[model samples]
Target: MSGHSKWHNIQAKKGKVDAKRGKIFTKIGKEIVVAVKNGGPSEDTNAKLRDVVAKAKAANMPNDNIQRAIKKAAGELNSVNYETIVYEGYGPEGTAVIVECLTDNKNRTAGNVRYAFSKQGGNMGSTGCVGFMFQSKGEIVIEKTDSTDEDELMMLALDTGAEDFAAEEEVFVVTTAPEDFGKVREALSESGIEFLEAGVKMIPDTYTEIDEETAVKFQKMLDVLEDDEDVQEVYHNAEFPEGWEG
Candidate 1:
């Protein structure tokens, strides 16, 4: 809310994800399967599954696909197994990056992730190499419309267990403790509030500003990671220059 705008980062990621909508759907479907396997297939009984379902819907994943994913994970259809893995490293200019992956073959995922990092002038490190620089939090973004009232929305979010609320240039961001995310999300949804994006994310404690050269390399690394079938999400602390489109 202070240093770099999270909204801008979200928009940039959305742009990248939009270009490969099918890949995004596949990534989300993997998440759904993992969630169902961890908990049950029932959203009502599985909070993790419910959260992943909401994320899938936000990404415009078809309901049919969502149901199929659940059924498959629950063994009604063909069964599959995946392991969640998190890799942390330093991107160009020592910018911290965290990549969340889901893979049945850890060896292949690790090799691919390491290759992406090295190819783009980054170095993959051990699990906690850059993990300490981030905190897991729930972030919900709502696009500001003509009827949006900053004051009312702030109050509502706060009352619904949000830890912080910030109004950006074109959207309102609601932050909450990780454990309170579902409660706040459900409360706002029940009030007819729509979200542009909602999920638990690894938010950097501070952002690292990068020069144009470094930004280019950093983005290339991100692109490589995001394109990997095993990679689900990539989080970073790099702040690109003004009007940078990478």
Candidate 2:
């Protein structure tokens, strides 16, 4: 599917293993709190909170940690106000990139993001600079199984309002319009389908291929931003060379 480009970030992070597990939990926790504050605490009644829970589960976050975060978010004394910010920029070789953050301090987040881009030989741009190069959509990834039928899965996904489906070697990826994401995901869940990852993401229309040297630089930029505590997600249009193992 067109949105598969975002998977590059996930694949790259796998190389780092558990080193960032705590930071990952922190980011997801902030998202859960924001979701709770925006809607309510009940996942059954709050669609966004439900998706955040699914995301937390996908990350292998501990049940106790998840329950703690939910309780804190729903408590009356929870006063932290997080703001969602999207930063657009261009990486090495003109590759488009977008960084999404949730932070209580906008100035701190902006400075951190700007430093990452500049330090990596890239430049931060205006709000819509690189945003127009990608489409916002919902992406759901399911690990492939022995009984997975491509045709059957495609039919089921489309019937449930999915926009597109692709069966990769290890996973089946489904794309849906932002508005239909929740409904489609619910339908799939009811059918006993398990998702490896699911979220609304920015998908590039086309990928920019860079040489080996530029790929290294591009990845460093991603790593710097991803390591930031306020940064939640990073999307880029860069495509690493085939067989060039991360």
Candidate 3:
């Protein structure tokens, strides 16, 4: 399960670098707008805004874009209201899948998501149909650099209220309670620690290994959902074959 998680994280980062940087920035920008609108433009006084800002930074979103989003949300510029929606489904071979979306038009987003699932031999399910298979937690990944000491980092994370720590081959994974995420991340940042990825994610309890053919179908479904503008995050339990590039 850890290995699969590591592989998925690496692929996600590579996907951002290879083709999805702009889309990622746009998504994070929307998140910033939502955060600012729900709270205020000032991160200092808005805890949600602070968390969004941290997420933006982790995604390498430009400071200018972040500020612009906040201004827009605060009415300094044009803004559009967005709503959060979550869809639960089963992928090929009955692997549990969950997609999180933010959109102004729920009808369009719902159609797109459902099509993505059905086109790849899967089907969208009712809310909570597959949600019970996963847990929501704050996850942080840090690269293993020459200066990174596993023991020291583990101690720091534990001392800073991290719930769990795992040292993977090329990265360190820190798990924290959802509410404690910001506090732990801030403390780690204050100590000059950098994160490759950090966000609240839905983690599956167990993984389901699939054949190559099923993996291809699953990957196609994932790609379709990920390429949708309204989609923010996609989580699943399907594990592909060793060294599967898809």
TM-scores of the models, in the order given: 0.94, 0.93, 0.94
Residue 57 alpha-carbon offset, candidate 2, angstroms: 1.4
Candidate 2 TM-score, true structure as reference: 0.93
**What is the TM-score (0 to 1) of candidate 1?**
0.94
| lDDT string, candidate 1, 2-62, tens digits | 3233667535556666788899889988888788777888999999998888788777788
Ranking according to lDDT, highest score first: 1, 2, 3
Note the Cα lDDT for every prediction shown: 0.85, 0.84, 0.84
Q: How close is candidate 3 to the true structure, as a TM-score?
A: 0.94
Which residue pairs collide, candidate 3?
none
RMSD of 3: 2.1
- Of the two candidates 2 and 3, the one with more favorable TM-score, higher being better, is 3
Clashing pairs in 2: none
Q: What is candidate 3's lDDT per residue for 112-203, written digit by digit as tens?
A: 99999999889999999999998888888888899988888889998999988887777788888899998998889899998878888888
Error of 3 at 1 (Å): 14
| Range of the 10 consecutive residues with the lowest summed lDDT in candidate 3 | 1-10
